[model samples]
Target: MPIVMDVDALMEFLRREFPQVSEDFVIEEVTEELTTVRLAVGERHLRPGGTVSGPTMFALADVGIYLAILARLGPVALAVTTNCSIDFLRKPASGRDLVSKTRILKLGRVLVVGDVLIYSEGDDRPVARASLTYSIPPRA
Candidate 1:
């Protein structure tokens, strides 16, 4: 399906709706088949072991999937995550950002499903993989 909201429009909507973490995420690319987002990792994102925290990675995955859905379905701010599963494969680099590549597997009228792969910036190996399901609100 064609994209209803482009990256610029999505970014603006996110910035206005989620001001807390909007700065941390940057929409790198958005296309009909895939969307890439970068997370600006800083000292605050690290855990005691000097690696990125699980919650941080999860947030990236969630946002990636949300953006992917919004790109196709337009600005649906009420759409919410109904389920998510994440597997941490490797430790993330503390000095680099995290990149998420997301693809929508299914986009139904009421539900959206997607998977995301996260890589440490500058590293080719994946640090995490996640699957997400979101509930799309009914149209008014």
Candidate 2:
């Protein structure tokens, strides 16, 4: 399927609905099969070890898949993550941005499943991988 919502439209919808997290992430690209999203990591995202925290990476994965689903299904604000499993493979770059490449595995009426690979900017290998399932609300 074609993307129903592009990056700018999706970002606007997110800014209007989820203002708190809107500033941390940017929807760089959106398409039928893939979505590229960026996390503007900051000092607050770091842990005691001077590395990006797991929760921060998890947020990036969740938002990446969420936006991918929205790009395909339009601005469905009620769609929520039903399940998520993330594996942190390597430490993220402290001074660079992080990017997520998200791809849909399944798209159904009530649920969407997708995988996300997060990599530090300019890196070829993923720093983390995540599988996410989202529950899409019924049409009103």
List per-prediction Cα lDDT, in the order shown: 0.94, 0.93
- Residue 97 error, candidate 1, Å: 0.2
How well does candidate 2 match the true structure in TM-score terms? Answer: 0.97
Give a tens-digit lDDT track for model 2, residues 1-140. Answer: 78899888999998999999899998988878799999998999999988999999999999999999989989888899999999999999878899999999999999999999999999989999999999999997
lDDT for model 2, please. Answer: 0.93
Clashing pairs in 2: none
TM-score of each: 0.97, 0.97
Report the alpha-carbon TM-score of model 1 versus the true structure: 0.97
Which portions of model 2 miss their true places by more than 4 Å? none
Where does the lowest 10-residue lDDT sum fall in candidate 2? 25-34
